[model samples]
Target: MLSDTIAAISTALGEAAISVLRVSGPQALQVAAQAFKLPPKLTPRMAHLVHAMDGEGNTFDHGLLLHFQGPASYTGEDIIEFHGHGGVLVTQRLLERLLACGARAAEPGEFTQRAFLNGKMDLTQAEAVMDLIHAQSTLALRAANEQLGGAVGRVAQAMQQEIIPVLAHIEAYIDFPEEDISPETGAALLLRLDAVLGRAQKLISTSEQGRILRHGARTVISGEPNVGKSSLLNLLLGFERAIVSPMAGTTRDTIEEIIQVHGIPLRLVDTAGLRESTDDIERVGIQRTERELERADLVIEVVDASQPPSGVHRLSLPPAVASRRILVLNKPELGIHPGWSSEPAAIPLSCVTESGIEQLRDAIRAVIATAGPLAADHPIAINARHKAAFERCAARITAARAALQSAEAPEFIALEIREALQALGDVIGQVDVEQILDVIFSTFCIGK
Candidate 1:
């Protein structure tokens, strides 16, 4: 149990109808009673109207004091919440009073961290708390909620359970080498390891899509000057995010914004038109555009449908980005013939009339769908840390299976299985807590 009591303003610091300050620890009730002038009897899980007072016994503010008895609350400890007036000064004063009563200031994410430390939640679920809070799109929120509901944890636990038996069987063989194991038993062990390996590999494959959903995919819009790149950007954003003009080279710098397309979050970067230019600023913008292209997960190559076929040569994209390119023929509203419509994988769209915009959105979703279709029910590893853990676990499992096939010593196979178990443990934070806890908790806000 944590010895120190912690307090923090749980709500945003601003004037509102009410602001909440949370306190949790062993002495939560005693500390709150010192600052809050509660009724003669305070009931656990009940809210009471109370007057907040300072050390001098001076009334500071009136609010609702809610008490939660230890071992049944959010942090599995005594918790108190003061929902007071939203004035910044008033909230700060209330927090100060709590501190004067022996409550220390809570660090960023310390509350949730405490919950994790107390076995209320695993590391993946703890991470989902922040993911749900910072989710930018509906899909992201669904994924986060699924994870918070113990989706990843359940899968990891299942893997651990499967590995434990194999490890035990190998250990038994190692201990009693005189009792030579039958060939059938060895083959059964290999089969079990292969099943777990297959599952781990499948989960590892979803990491890319999971990452894209958590942190929006990096999408760079590229094409020649005056090909409706800015217009398409504004259309996709549903607002005028980028400057649009008939003149060429209007966007001299990359403008980025996060937008959701078909429930998938896209970190959209509208880069300057790719063309040779005499203007120094335009050249710099072009150079930056090239750099952005190198890092792009998906590139929207805007081609002017109104231009002749010869104009296609102007879109000189690097061969490296060819696989991720989506050829878009913009300006269909111009009444100009789309001569390049027959081109493979070319989406003709009209930014002015908003025609074929749905197709563009569908195309963007298609690129992500290649990894796997995302459903609210599916569990995914949303962070690179989880992905790395899965990868490591899979590698060990694969190696163990290979060792079994090669008829390697039982001790050697057991070592591989132990390493695999350790890697899986890292996923649910059963191991290496000190190394990853700080990094994970640091992303959360103080109140969480």
Candidate 2:
């Protein structure tokens, strides 16, 4: 029940300077008093140092107790934080005390969920709280912070505002068919709905960038055996993650490692060389390499520049990867074959001397920058939920537009508009089903 006093250890359990135990509910202060012997007279937002106790009232440790008053707290209820010693044992014991003192253990995300329910933030902002925590790069961090600051929510709210007026107008005519809307008015409604839908499509387009920010770009390196694929991987990762050997088929599996190409992270995979192999394991490895190629956002094909080039024919790639592929003529330190000059696009350098690695890194950064929509300082990186909501919202608006154009009953058009508005509510992360009805009742002036 929401009325139940809940407690959770906010900080990860480890030896740190301090660990914080969060308690929130109507009985937060009382629970804190039981666990910490906190004085009845307390000041909101003020930290008080007190000796923490267990259920038996035995002093366990000295800690700071901070109180947040109801209606102003994170969950919009009274909250108490116990800043205790960082030792894992001490933190666990302190938290046990909180639960023993009438506070139940909080479910994962309960606090943020409560904040959403209490009107502290909308769904997007609450989801962004986790995004900010899981941010992997500078761009990802900026996007998450922007979302947390209500960037996406504001967009949804603006979209709702645009939709509601049109919905209200349609409904106004539906309630009174005598006022049968003029075609000019119908055209204006279409324009207003188109604007809202255009914004939805714009947000929907950012889903790719959002996935890249969250998971990093899947960069797969492919080539024949002994073409220095592992060598390039080591150079990028600054360590020997994959074994390099003169023996063919030495690498019979894919090796993955993460490295930052500028600020964006590259989930670099050094796959088994693409080739025909008689051995079963080698053939399986080759098959896996093909699968990785199909899925890769970027494929870097390394070729031996020392060998006389037959032709500059790059490896055949999946249509998805064709535009994102980079051809590299490695081992230039050994001396580039004369025929290699024909292919100017392939980067030429030697892994033996670690030369041209910077250029390769620069190439990677370029692909990530231009290929992704996250080039802006603060991007609208919509997660899965937002993308689905935007799509649904856009679809409903499109349906409503079709109904309006066909001069279908105003009732059907208004129904689609209401659903579209409800879909925007999903974008905001609020799922109150009756909200559309509330808008209809409150926004329309029956007297008019």
Candidate 3:
């Protein structure tokens, strides 16, 4: 039912060997025909070699023109693809020619949005499309692929299937009050609700790990002055990105770099030495260090192995930091004391000599692998929007449980269950309105 043609440059705007201009809609082929001065007698759904020209018939670039028929194309509509030399002016001219020929400029993610609206993909799959494109690591790519294959949607659908029958039973009782759909029927619904709740709870628990994979983990390096925090950062990254000097407080600000540790993305942050300082600049650095630690997913508490852990320290952090820290005993070359063993299973190493780097990498890998892969049958909630929706749905389910336990009327229980189902529908894109679709698609790049 789409009426107008849409066009956009699919590749990134920069110097490249080639750029693909994509067109989708009923007039996709016609728009390409107007731009490409090909010989007569060429049919639709065929690639034609010709000179692509502007509206004035001035030759721009010679390339191949491909046509796709409706219902069989990417957007589930007629489409055209122009493969031409990459040039900013050249691509702009071609798009302008098409726009003048009844084609409209595609909005950000308009193509994919069309595909979703045209029944080519559901909301979950559309979101996965972007996740796959922006994947920072192999683990993230794998999770996106799994969701694109409908793992998340299938789980939501299964939950809906379970709830539908119970709802139908309630409605049947409401319609026939004399029928023996008694307290036992309500008990059965409660049992079914518990089962669904268990499944949703499991998905919700994966949110933290899923988020870590989708958006790389934030790991910060923190320790008192002269503890080799900068050295450890350089060692973990396998490059001297941070300044390493003999002077204390060399790194006066936070330094960040993204690196792969066992195919998982880790956003490694190196902050200034965490210590009490009277110098104005050093004090500002210390304050920033505290804020970073508060937001860290993991903290590498580097202690100088040459020195023993003393009862009193300049940078005494909150107890929460201690609980979340993985102690790194730097400067093993200088030798460690027996008292260092009390510092939470420290990894002894010499960052200058790159000692124990592999062991440290392995430890980090173990932490992320805790929620590696859900079972083939269990679905994951990797998207933040879906996670929020599931949380709301879980709350409604909890309320429904209470209602059934208190022997509430069938109508009240049905309403609560319906509310839960609607929330799940929103997660899978079943309840998305035009406005929500606009927001989601607008976040995507035009070509995507």
Best by lDDT: 2
lDDT of 1 by residue, 118-215 (tens): 88999999999999998888998888988999988888888887777677656645554555532337778888788888878878877878888888
Count of backbone collisions in candidate 3: 0
Name the 10 consecutive residues with the lowest summed lDDT in model 1.
Answer: 437-446
- Clash count, one per candidate: 0, 0, 0
Model 2: per-residue Cα lDDT over 1-448, one tens digit each: 7899999999987899999889999899888877787776788898898899766678889988889998999999999988888999989988888888899999999999999999999999999999889887887788888999899999999998787767666665666556554323777988998999899998988887888887789999988888989988988888888899988778889999877677786789998986767899999998999899999988998989999864433478877788888888898978888887877877986888878877888887777665556636446889888999899999999999999899898889888988888888888866454554566556553445
- lDDT per residue for candidate 3 within 90-142, as digits (tens), equals 88878888798888999998888988889888788889899889888877778
> Each model's TM-score, in the order given?
0.91, 0.93, 0.89
Question: Which candidate, 1 or 2, has the higher TM-score?
Answer: 2
lDDT of the candidates, in the order given: 0.83, 0.84, 0.78
Off by over 4 Å in 1: 176-184, 311-320, 431-448
Judged by whole-model lDDT over C-alpha atoms, candidate 3 comes out at 0.78
Rank by TM-score (best first): 2, 1, 3
